[model samples]
Target chain A: MEEILQLVVFGIVIGSIIGLGSMGLTLSYGITKFANFAHGDIMSLAMYIAYFIVVDLGLMGPTVFSLSFGWGMFLAIAVTIILLAIFSIAIDKLIYKKLRRDKSNIVTMAIASLGVGIIIRAVVTMFWGPFARNFVPGIHEAVPITGNILIKPDQIFIIALTIVVTIVMYYLLYHTKLGKAMRATADNPDLAAVSGININNILAYTWAITGALTAVAGIMLGIQAQVYINLGFNLLLPMFAAVILGGIGNPWGALIGGFVVAISSEVSTAWIATGYKPAVPFVILIIMLIVRPRGIFGSNI
Target chain B: MDFLIIENSYLLLTATGVMNWFVGFLTTFAIFAIMALALNIQWGFTGIFNFGVVSFFMVGAYTSALFTIGPPGEYENYIMGFELPILFGWFAAMITSGIVALLIGLPTLRLQRDFLAIATIGIAAILRAVALSTEGFVNRARGMNGIPRILGDVVSGPDYKWVLLAITLTTLVIVYLLVEKITASPWGRVLRSIRENEETTKSVGKDTVNYRMQAFVLGAMIMGLGGAIWAHRMTSIDPEAFNDLFGTFLIWTMVMVGGNGSNKGAVMGAFLCCTFWFGFPLIQESLPDILGNKVFQLREISIGVLIILFLLYKPNGVIPEKPKISRHL
Candidate 1:
């Protein structure tokens, strides 16, 4: 029971990060109507950005908010979000816009995105030299909840942040006129155009918000674990699995799917070897694809 | 007089260098040509999107290496090495790779194009992870190295590479002719029809899934043959050698650039792109100090830019495959 609880807690922590990442992917896919393979790389890039701001900037020591530690985390998160948003917009203009203009096939676009991903990975590798870095200092401290069951502060923070972000995203996606317009565009771009929703503007906003969410998820992940160049590359498969399993272009389903993937994978480590953890999501993805191609919560818009 | 002689000699020397470079380019072109033709049958002909051709290539290389090197009977670090004749080992490697492809294709062939692509990538990733795992088969990350060279002892060392190159080129030519004939036949026409509209082909009583599987398996076999030839030429094998995304991406790019659905275009694309890949880096390295490093970076950037440009501007590739005209009537 203790081990199970411990595993569940740990699973939830990572699951929250997966949820956040999947939200960004789901939003982008909903708006763009194409699966962005480079989404995971964006997460990695944002994490690296936050790492630079917090650790390399030497902003850890000072206390700002009357709390114990300084507001370095907030600062890092803010800067990362801004950078990621700008990066996404730039990517839209430089790479994706051209493909869109040409009316490229889905496969061509996917391949182009892969090329972009390779470039991003290579540039990151060139700069960072394939090493892992951490943002927070003394992050290993664990609070003992019970016998053989301990919870880390970072994990608690991740869960809390995930809930807060999900609530905010739900409100923004449902309550606002802009959110309505976004949904309109996603439902039927042609009809949305007829209804006076600017397709390009909605897409731009979607990219910006998605980019910010991706950055926040990256920072949270970095805080929990560590940041590396291949961090996003490693997560790409599982994240895709989560997205597909939940239903493509459905943010709510993505959140649930993330937790499901995370818990299942972690639990499977007990029965199967740890090395096969990545395979768990892929197997799930295959099964889901065969059994329920549309996914659990997916509905045609 | 000395300056004049040196200048005159420089032209001759450059001519010889160009000739040698062409020879090297042709050798590589031949190997990739076979693989590209295979891809044409799958993607261009049957519309089966396989994003994991490299895995089959890796299998082919490893299989041939293990067989030629004999059983690592005493060497507990390495697994699966049975001493066998060269021809038999190469044939076995081809068959094994085909079987692996069939295994992967069986479940995945029913998927849509996008799902198929994702599944193929997953398989590639799994194969790579298996290769890298320490406890798994093939000795973890250390990789099998130092396989025996086929035909090197029979022919002189310097002459052997050229001889093997000739053999590869011949095989490529044979494969190309065979593919051209096949694609022009009634069966090939059905594949093209399937590519254009699978539903229409199915309506016409064609089993599209079975046809796709056939194309995929045939492509895998050709890729395996290429891998066998490459292993013999290099006489070394490693998991890392095949792990890079370039292995699959480069082949796809070659196919796209040459002209999908055209064997001639596939051959041309493989030869030209590979030559540029090998030669451009050398030229970059040879440039004067300030420009040399910049050129290398530019080369990397150009690859990404070119892929985008090609997709946008020349979706059909440089030399589009011409529709076959029947002369029988």
Candidate 2:
């Protein structure tokens, strides 16, 4: 039972990260109507940007509350988020926008996104090289929650950040006028345009929002694990699985789906070899595709 | 004797070791061409989206290697090493790949193309993971080595590559002709019809799903064959070699750039892309270490850019599919 509890805690930490990442993907799919295969690469790019600022630039500051990084990391995250948003918008203008103007199909869009992903990965590889890096050098001890159940402060920080982000996301999607327009555009672009919504503006905003989310998720992942080039690419499948499970384009559904997938996969580690952990999400994805492809919450934007 | 003299001058280019380079280049081209042709049959002819081409290739290569390698010695451990002839290994590779395809296709083929693509890629990743993780099964991450080469006894050293090249060309020509023949037949027409418009094909009383399954399975079998050929050429194999970047995406680029639904385009695409792929090393040699180190990254970026540019400008590819004119008309 204690072991299960520990696993559950670990699962929640991972799930929150996945849920945050999936929200970005789901939003991109919602507005763009194609799986932005570059989403994960973009996340990796953000993490590398943060690493460059924190590590390479010598922006050292005192560590806070058992978390690995210092004030520099927080600043890095902020700067990275802004840069990522602009970078994503630039990518849209460069690649996706042209394809969209050509009236390309979803498959074409997906393929283009894949190309964008490859380019991003290659660029990251060029700059950072293939080796892994860390934000802080030392290993931090886990804080005990109960008998044999322990949680890291960083994990707690992640969960807290997720909850806060989720609340903010709710407000943006439900209460704000721009959010309404965004939802309108996602639902039926033709209808949305007929009603005088600037589709281009919505797209830019959507990319920006998703890009920001990707920054947070990527940084969290970096803190939880190690910063590497393949980091984002590796997480791409699981994020897709989470998005599909929660229902594409539904943020809340994605959050729940993220938790479900993470917990299930983490629990399965009890039986299966740890190396096969990556396969678990895919197995779930396959089963979901066969059983309920529309996803649990359905494809509501 | 005159033919031999002419052959050495024309084909060998022995003085500059150009023959060695050319042979290696062509061999890689032939293997990738076979795989690209398989993609052409699936996506080009049948419109069956498969993003996991590498998985089938891996399955085929490993199956053949396992079949022919001698029983595991002390250092290495894996499942089967029947010590069969290389011919049996190749045949077994095709059959195994086909069966794997059938199993994977049955569940996912009935769904959307996205589902099929995702499922295949996911499965490919899983298979690689399995190969890496299963220590007792496939010798873990160390991978198998020293499988007997084809015609190992008869041919030796520099002479052997020529024989291998001849065999590869023969296999390529046979596969090419077979694909061309199949695509021209009435069944091929049904597959094309499904690609163009599945609903219309269904209305015409054809079992679209069954036809798709057949195409998918057949294409996978061809990929398996390509994998087997590649394994024998390399003489050793590892899980790392079977990645999506090379195994799936590159093949997609070749097919798309060559022109979808055209077998000749597939072959031409493979040839050109392989040239671009292999030409990098030559370019790298001219530059400093720091600059040369970035060549791989540059190559991948170029491929990505190439894919996007092609999709935007020439989506149909270099050799666009020609409409078949009825003979009676």
Candidate 3:
């Protein structure tokens, strides 16, 4: 019973991370029409930014509301998201825009995204020297929820944060005018353009929101697992599995898909070896592909 | 007179050593050239974006190594412990990887364009994950070592490398001719047509899936052969050795830099990349520890930057893919 609860708690945290990280990928795929391989690296970049702020800037000494990090990490996260959004736009303008102008195929853009990822990975290694770094120095003790159930304060913080973010995101998607415009644009770009929607504005918003969401995922992952050069790249597969499992281009589907992948991966460890946990989602994905090519809630685009 | 004589002998020895390094460099180039050719058949000829080259290559290496290497003895325990013929091992590698490709390609081919890349990357990771964790398969983490060399016993030392070079180059020439022949055939035209526009080709009655599957399997077979050659050269095998940068990304860059649609361009790009990929290790030995490692990593960055720059600046590559004459024209 204890192990199951522990795994479930861990699963939720991981699921939220996947959900947040993959929100950007699915959004970009919907609006931009290609998977940004560099998004994973961008997440890594965000996590590193947070780490640098916490460690290098001496935000390491304080505690806030039972969490190890303080205001500096929060400030760093804000800065990271803004900078990452701007960076995404710059990359689009510099690299992808040319391909778009030339009417290049999706494969070209995808490969270009890979190139972008490689460049970032190289930059990270060059700067950080290819070693793993931790955000907080030591391990935090878990508090008992009951006789059998114990969870960390950070874990609770993560769950609450995820829920708050999800509510805000849901409200933004359903209630806000800009959100409707974004949704309309994603549904039918040609029609949206015909309807006089500012496609460029939507694209920019998409980039910014995607960057922000990707950042959150990266930071959360860093908190759970140590931040390394390959942090984002390693998650790339599972994130993709989630996106595809939910059906590409559907954000809500991606949210659900994230939980599916996270839970399955965590649960399967009882039978499958721990090292092969990553493979569990992959097997699920392949089976999903065979049974339902478009995914559960995904409409074939 | 004694000092002068010593200097002359040192210069002579250095010359011989550098010549040996050059020979080894050429051999590395040949193996990469085979991979470039295989990738060309897939991406260049058929436009099937395959990012799982490393997985197939690893499979090939292990399969062939398993076929030929003697029993694991006391230290290592592995499946199919036998000492088969060299040619048989190489053949077995191709067949094994080819079948692996076919099984994976069946359901995935019908998906959207980049999904293939995503799916293949997943598949490759799963493969690596399994290889790492499974105790029964290839002895898990320690990896199979001390595999018998292909022609290590018969030809030896400096002169034997020349024999190895001759053999490697001969294979390259044969693969080049075979690929050229296939690309020149009408069937090749059909494949190119699909690349130009899959839906249109399908409308015109070509079995696009079959052709793609063919390209994928054939290319995988070639990659396997490349892996087999690599294992033999190293006299060992490891899951880590067949990494993306070394196996998939590097070869893709080679094809991209060389000219994806052009066979000769693929071969040309392989030689150029091999110069950087292999040449650096030799130079690294001469440099200070930290500096050498940094320079080594810079190569990866350069490849990444190169892909972006090329895509932005030179999409057709160093040797531009010649526009095929359409039958309608």
Off by over 4 Å in 3: A299-301, B1-13, B280-293, B326-329
Model-by-model DockQ, in order: 0.41, 0.74, 0.69
lDDT of 2 by residue, A1-301 (tens): 7777888899999999999999999988878878887888888888899999988998848888778668898899889889988988888888889888888767778878888888989988998999988888778789899877999888898899899989999999999999999888877889999999999999999999999999999989988988887888888888889988988788888889889889988988888889999998998888888899888998776
DockQ score, prediction 3: 0.69
| lDDT (Cα, tens digit) per residue for candidate 1, span A193-225 | 999888888888888988998998888877777
Ranking by lDDT: 2, 3, 1
Residue B176 CA error for candidate 2 (Å)? 0.6
Model 3 error, position A91 (Å): 1.4
> Which fraction of the native contacts appears in each prediction?
0.26, 0.69, 0.76
DockQ of 2: 0.74
User: Ranking by TM-score, best first?
Assistant: 2, 3, 1
Write the residue-wise lDDT of candidate 3 on A29-130 in tens digits: 888888788878888988887887778877655678888677777777777778888887788878877898888888889898988888888878877778
Docking class of 2: medium
For this target, which candidate reaches the highest TM-score against the unseen true structure? Answer: 2
Query: Candidate 1 DockQ score?
Result: 0.41
lDDT by residue (B114-186, candidate 1, tens digit) is 7777777777777877777646377667767667666766887556657777888888988998989988888
Across B1-329, the per-residue lDDT of candidate 2 in tens digits comes to: 00111223333345546767787778788989999999999999999989899999999999999999999989888999999999999999999999999999989898787667777878898999999998878887888898888888789988888898888888999999999999999999999999989999999999999999999999999999999998888878889878878899899999989999999999999988888877665566567889776988888999999988999889989988899888899
Candidate 3 chain A least-lDDT 10 residues: A292-301
**Global CA lDDT computed for model 1:** 0.77
> Could you tell which candidate, 1 or 3, scores higher by DockQ?
3
The value of fnat for model 1 is 0.26
**Each prediction's whole-model lDDT (CA):** 0.77, 0.88, 0.82
